[model samples]
Target: MPTSSVVVVSKCSVYPDLKSTVKSLKLSVSDLPMLSCQYIQKGVLLPHPPLSSADLLSLLKLSLSKTLSHFPALAGRLHTDSAGHVHILCNDAGVDFFHAKAPHLSTEALLPPPDRDIPPPFRRFFQFDNTLSFAGHVKPLMAVQVTELGDGVFVGCTVNHAVVDGTSFWNFFNTYAEVAKGVKKISRSPNFCRDTVFNSPAVLVLPEGGPSATFSGDEPLRERILHFSREAIMKLKARANNPTRNPDFCAPEILGKQSNDSWGLNCKINGKITEENGLRKDPTAVISSFQSLSAQLWRSVTRARNLNAGKTTTFRMAVNCRHRLDPRLEPLYFGNAIQSIPTIATAGDLLSKDLSWSADLLHRNVVAHDDATVRRGVKDWESNPRLFPLGNFDGAMITMGSSPRFPMYDNDFGWGRPLAVRSGRANKFDGKISAFPGPEGNGSVDLEVVLAPETMAELENDLEIMQYVS
Candidate 1:
């Protein structure tokens, strides 16, 4: 509840467009009223030192109550009428607080102790024991726990996926630090209105003669989440980055190896066998792999399976479109400033696609993104007389560069920089992948993959193979 930490870094300059970016996000989703910030709250547990349990709880409740008053967004309440539409409750809901108790079991060597039970608060919120359901009511997105360690308290926090992305979440946490430190006054600000950006979508229609493209499906496919372990990830990253000890090895070298060594590609297809109905070379795709995966994906990729014979599968990469958009909107406009570019080949294709081919295709695609015509093409497609194809793609792999220079880590609230920070959930689509910087500031990144069970196993096997090679 009390924000206090040593300082690591600081940025006094405010991004001029910061407020506009937030305003744009609220506007873009005006149609989805249920997705408001009033319901978006973060849970953090902080350990107390030299304090009694009762005394600690009381102090926390008071601090949290005061902290909520300052956020304005959290202080406000929401209500759903009989119509099922959400309305802002004009009054304060007053932050709620309750004491957490550890379960008890008598020590007995003869019999195994009863299964360790989860605390009530954790159960109601995390439901860590249950399977995740996308359609179910989204529970509390995050919760922070304060545990009393020997010398100090540890603060743990969790957040929901729908309310904020990583950038916005940190922004909120920074604001919290500002509030707890008495640096800023909390006002009953009504900043969550959605009309600011989308308020004028009609004026931003696309231009005619949009770009040509094809779609795997008419709709943007649903996303999936996955998680991978730290050790296994490190091994894959090391191999991907520098497969050969030879100093000359670079992207080209790695790319070539990936294509030529893929399982199906390594095995040649007989020319005569191609004449058979099901013997044609597989048309699968292998896309770019990133440096790391988000925490939520650790489990999914760890359990993925390999692809079935002859089935086509491709990996995808999300390219940031911030700079590629209208130059007039440049200087770094935020809010979904990205689009998915897919590179696919079957599992065999991934192994067989020559690195030069993969690299060339990547180079071409990357260059195409730089041209202004791409935006024009997008506009043309939007305004076309009939539906336009976006692209044919199966899944995605997202790469995020570490911004240690960004104020994200230095967002000090009278406290020191965070030891760890990450997204609450992985991407929402199957074939989704994520990554972030690893410790030690090495060029390597942590990675995660979300694939079907069979595909996941295949990836693991491939990873083992890479380990053996290096």
Candidate 2:
């Protein structure tokens, strides 16, 4: 079979020329941690529209300019002051936009079935590799690539991670989509006030050369998409909260497939299982839908890797601190306002526990992050600034970065709603998994799993794990 090919047609800088007096936006405490992290490289795939390729491209570019008028910081570049503080110089620096073509690629090829690997041709729509976030000092803070495929189109955006997180990134994307459809008023504009995140001014000192992006961009891995239906999630949630003797639950740990102990003993006490006794239930720890799924994935991946029983396994997830704080933040707060929370357990213990045990473990940790926790975290970072440790260096860590709650399918750029969402090859490691909401908005989820070929093979063959995967 002939592989798909992408030919870059043109690259240009797009300026908003807002003619405003806003000069700069300082990097917040939430943003500084991402200096070493790779850019956010994600976009959507759409069906072929009625407009000719030329007209569609022109409309996209023009609307991008109009959209940037609301997000001036995106058209700016990063800067470092004498005291080592970083800022986004809102100088209308312009965004890097690219035009590309993949004449032989089709939607079917770009989106293979869940069992197959995602083709590399889809990644060609992205311009950045594992470029560090600090590179925004010289490069465009945001880069957009529009590729023309055989039957449809792909619009991929690469935004500096230090500037916008998943929430702010999608805000801009949805805004751009509305602008493309001729919406004059932006429904949600980014709020640039720093006080929303901190009571006092926040300054971040850079490491001597800043954080290093250690990815080689050539790791041999399988990019597998795991789709779980809404019904599957509801079933998982019910299994975790309520008592059940069903043998169909996913998660090797919960099924007692990885251990010698009986699953019933680990899950139940004295022939009765309730929220009280099933999970050593923390009265305040209410297991969430996503936490159950994450716990299951953690267990599945651990079993797939076939790690030693004594090995330590850790799971980290990005938590949105917007509504968790006391006063709460502005809904449209720009820049980063998220934090990573980690939960650790021994492989032996995690696998020995029941489904609700791990699910409640995640829940307790998430619920413990309150007002004081956020304040204390900021204080600690102020004393010692560091870049986000994104990669899974030891192969025993699972990092879930994105959320399945983001309104991704709602973006319609005049043509139609997106058929699917895809990401680039930036900051992807062996155990890194990005979760996206299903394109149908039906409470389903799609997890883009990146792992070694051997582990992926093991995970694929793990029959119990494959039960929940559609």
Candidate 3:
């Protein structure tokens, strides 16, 4: 297929005055020290429109303006203080708005098959220009691109990650949609009080962390989409629940005999095993679909890379701390409220361990991020601000974000729900994975995996992995 070219129809700044209800906002401690670099892009394709391009543009502009009036921080620009702390300058400088068109493309053409790679044209839907650089004094913290396609309209938003995480990003979009749809009251109003996160005056600095230098190579990274159906997920659950054929061989020494007893006991306690003839009953686990899928991908990706068995591999899982913290944050609390829970394991042990073992490990790590841990993390970062050390991907370090719980497919601007939602190419970093709810809304998962070309090739054909993909 020929790549559809996007032409910019209009470019302008959208300055929306903050409503009287909104006060001057600042970046919270959790938001500081983040790379003023990355932008989170979300692309939504709305089918055959009820409104013309001009009408849609006007509606979007008016709605976005009103929405920003409530979310005044988005209309602001990033500024650094004398102590190097980043803050939002709620000056209503404005967000960048681009009106674009892809005359030849259709929503259908852009929605690639499950086994195929997302086309480059699909990514062009997002407007990512000066919105990405926070070093400038007048840079936009958010950018919106509205593209007219043959069959539908594509709305792409790029929000600076330094100011917003996945939750805040979607919250902004959903609110925009609500306004466009003429909803009188938004379901979740944003809470912009930065003081709620921290009261310390010290400038927060992110811990220094990047891809491992030792494993850095020149190989190009590739992105692929992997689909796991509801049925497939069920089978994976079953497989994970089933007792290993060779427990003595597969179980690590750290688990020992107690590991076998625990596995059997869990199944028995959960009624996953029948009293008669020892036939396996319904699968159940303390771990959830997220843990199971994450564990499976981590193990399969490690094997696909053919990494040294003795090498250390880490899985950095992003955990939402909104509810995990004491005096839980409101559902619409804005800014970055995510903490990474890292689980480290030797490649040999990780590869050799049973799926349940890995899932249990992930589950435990996730459960560990309670109120105390989150508070401690905040204090630690406050005392010595530093970015999370994410050493080189080199196939050993993996980072997973986004969540099936996100309402990516639910943002409707009166033209019906989005036919497909996608992430921008900027997320295509090696060993990075994003999880989205399946198109069917049937409790399945669609994973967007980015890996080196060779590793991806191997992953595509791996029998063990393919067994659960369909």
Candidate 4:
């Protein structure tokens, strides 16, 4: 077992000029219920040539102050309006910062093959106090924990998802890194206009009447880290694109020449795909490494849960809407810009089919988010705001977070790039999954999955799933 002691607890506030005059900013519909309960947890390990605790503490505090100056919303607190809508009070209330020491843990122990129980060392680094709630009057929207270990330093951050999505989350860290490296100017600045999506001052209401159920607590969930190397991802991609691999598989429609009618179907400019025509193109031709692995994991998780073949299973994927919306959002828009796109299929159809079928379904559902669909989704939420369903470990549903595209490992705070990056144990909810870029810097993916113990045992031994992994 590994133990840690808190060395310091301080409040980090935004710089003066970044403060907002508007007392409160109403959260967009997408920022309502789900964001309120979710916290983005990240752990980065820096090894060797260690700085003294004092030096690290001073360095981080200074850099954070500079970073927060630009991202003023993070320094604010979450508050609720009379009508039950969640909003950010930009009163310059500080973020919770803690510096701790872990005497017995090593960076090596945190590596992959996460089949064992959740490690105590990593858990201690990313601890979240379930007792804290955003609905409270004075809750910090961001909390930082710096755990000094034997071989490396682990920096863990828990940012309120109600304020920012994965993109904005990383944007904060990357900017902090730049400031730490003595960069005079930041490449991107945040757009704090919450009304970009909702032009009016409409208070968003959740159908559930309140925030979503917090997944925090002592739930009987197991956390496992699975890494799919670059070669492994390529193999999975080839398998998904090959129709002969599965007897019932059909070649997904490929996006060839696009006619005006197909303008939004296959049109992609600068990595932004237009979905105006709906997702009618062949999915196999356009399947990405993320989509391929996601499909495999979805199937394996479903089978491991052993749901009834006749039952309907749902897969909720977090789609970054920065480039998917009309006119596209600013690159540095520092708020929740993710849409939880859900796909429903009968267990019989999903299980009876091949990897290609599952991949196609996943790909199509993702590409279906066009300019019109995104606006329509916002309007729908305005009329009937509801939390994204949090499915159970009984295997009928799954939710995904984070992304390989976010350049998480690149955050080098003057020391060096992280040896490994991880999510906190708080993400260990049954049927939850997180994807990160593999450590090799190649285009590989590291998938962290949380499942019930029995289901995980079954998934570990799954031959088909194991084939694409090491």
Candidate 5:
């Protein structure tokens, strides 16, 4: 299939001016870390457009403009203050929209056999290959690309990471779908206020131009969009909740037994949470689909790498902090309110522990990051703010991003439910995994896993991980 070329790139402005209403929105500590990240590029693949390319684009452009009215930051510019802090100048400048056509390409190209890697054309589906989130200072804060396929349309959107996180990004996407499908009223109005209930601003001066959001494109990686069926997920969840001790499950030798005094394992138990010596001991202690799946992935990846027992491995998760606060941020609060929590354990411990044991570790660590924890992170950053470390720093780190909770398949621009979800090569590195929900509302999940060539080969052959990989 020949790659698609962006035939046209135009500016799509918001419908009404909002400068008077929102003069300038301040950047929060959470938003600052993303300055080092590239634009968040993700979109859906809808089959068979009912209208022609021109006709469909006109409707989409109009709907997108109206949608931008609700999300001014998407159309605004990033402004830096004298103190070196960043802010959004809500001037309604507009976002970049690109139109493309792949005359020889077919939708089938993107939907390859489950055994093969994602087709290369999916990389050409978006326009922002090198644009960083901080580049919003001079470039459009957002960009959308619509590609006409033989049997489908690829609606790829790239939003400034410094402006919105995954939650707010989907909010704007779904709102556009609503308006495009003829919904007059905005379903979820965005709240762009950066003032939080546990607020503390981290104003750090920049070095040179700003943090470079570059990822070496030269690295060879295997990006697999693995879909886990509801049944497969249930199997993992069952294993995570079961107390049947397997001969292979080994207790940690050096770390000894796990401790339970902090916050009483505020973790999300499958049914009811009961604590025993800092851990859940119930044979029926249920675990969630995400917890089960993530823990399994964490363990399987570690095993595949075949690292030394004493080497430390880390799991970094982007946690939402809105409702976790004491007072709680009001609903629909926009901007980045996420804290990337890094959970650490020795490779030996993760590999030796039972599935439930590792899941419990992930659960308790997340639960422990409550209001005070979030506040302390902010103040610590204020003392010395730094850009996000975007790679596998310790050669044993796995970073989990995007959530199955995000409404990825809800991007039905009146065409129909999406056939699948896809993304571009922006800020991608080895050991980075992104989770998306299955098309049906069942318990199934999809993981977009990126890893080195050798690791991916070993992981694909790992039967334990493959047994539940539907």
Candidate 6:
């Protein structure tokens, strides 16, 4: 779609709280050179009456300048290195920052179909037209794309893993929202003071030495994160509470059955094959039998646990806490901060155990990841000099990432928000699931799954019986 002309509203002022927060950030990390991975990008929808090209440019500059004025910390990236010279690569001439392409205004595709059985993580590259990419790993990493939709637009933005966690990302976004609205007061301020939590050299030791020691032998012997349809979750709920059956069935009860069925001999991994009964016997029979028994035991515990009573089905939301480190660094501070949390189940848990059991289990696991115990472990390791080691888990697996759809869709650059947004380059992982805004503010989530054709086909074949968990 050609860039349409829409008169966009401008947020002419930056909030005071945001202004001070940015100022403090700049002061705390003043000595360090700006890392290349910390840039931020945004999009916003403009109703009818878009601005002309010239007017749009002017508005973008005006908004950006004002934002920086209040959030001077952003200017750190534009700063020089220890040699008193800014990195040449930070200049526009060095980075490939450009507007990306968007699907033209097409009524047919406006409401994309809901994806079923999105494989694990990286396979999601198949669902869209473009993806974010990079040439070399750099600090304060950045990627941007702006595409014109027929009546709308789509914007894509990405920051490197080295710098900033999700909280920082949203912190920046909320700042933009307040500034764009010309609000004087910001609801929250970003906390990046690393010293409050860590001495510099101590903070520096985490990325270098901690992970390997802590995570050794800590990897799950078998682990998989799965998804179910909203409908499937409901079905399970009914089965657990069937008055005609056992009113005693609870979340753990339902989950015991579901987990066994889901993970038992039937689950295919490591190229292992199963017989018609979802088992493999003979010499391998002993091993397969153990697997079956383990599944049964775990399920039994789930049923006995009654974990579903008041729980809400939720997405396993993972947030990296590396940034929460003491002696707060700039948004550009690099390294991992991925701390996982569950979105929290909003729907009833005990009642929907059958339908939502899987979702519930996943949600529970995710929430458990946030225990102060887990974080303390992370902090303890950070204090050491070894690089944080990834548990036995491979970074390249079929997994889902937090969706960018909600965050990147409406970035305004003096123009209007884009019509839609999506991700770029499929990552190193496999089955990738992403979430975007549902159609017409219906409050439903539109999920995009990218998976191997075989995995997708298997899921499609079972769609009728699929239940969405959290």
Q: What's each prediction's TM-score? A: 0.47, 0.90, 0.86, 0.85, 0.89, 0.50
lDDT of each: 0.32, 0.81, 0.72, 0.70, 0.77, 0.34
Ranking by TM-score: 2, 5, 3, 4, 6, 1
Give candidate 4's TM-score.
0.85
lDDT of 2 by residue, 192-310 (tens): 88766553355665657666875555678889899987657656765665545453443345433211111112333234332433443533434666887888888889989998999
Which 10-residue span in candidate 5 carries the lowest summed lDDT?
Answer: 254-263
Error of 1 at 21 (Å): 17
| lDDT digits (tens) for residues 57-133 of candidate 1 | 44444445554443333333333335433333323433233333322211121112212111222212211122121
lDDT of 4 by residue, 179-202 (tens): 877889987777877657744355
Per-residue alpha-carbon lDDT of candidate 3 for residues 237-295, written as tens digits (9 for 90 to 100): 44554544322222233222221112222223233333223333432334555677788
lDDT of 2 at 297: 89
Q: How well does candidate 5 match the true structure in TM-score terms?
A: 0.89
Worst 10 residues of 6 by lDDT: 25-34
Better of 2 and 3 by lDDT: 2
At residue 61, what lDDT does model 1 achieve?
47
Residue range 86-165, candidate 6, lDDT tens digits: 22122221222343333444323442334422111111112221221111123223333333444544434444322344
Model 5: how far is 20 from its true place, Å?
Answer: 6.4
Q: Is candidate 1 or candidate 6 better by TM-score?
A: 6
Candidate 3 structure, TM-score to reference: 0.86
Structure candidate 4, residue pairs in collision: 252-282, 253-282
lDDT of 6 at 53: 42
Error of 1 at 381 (Å): 10
Candidate 3 has an lDDT of: 0.72
Which 10 consecutive positions of candidate 2 have the poorest summed lDDT? 257-266
RMSD (Å) per prediction: 14.5, 6.3, 7.2, 6.2, 6.6, 14.8
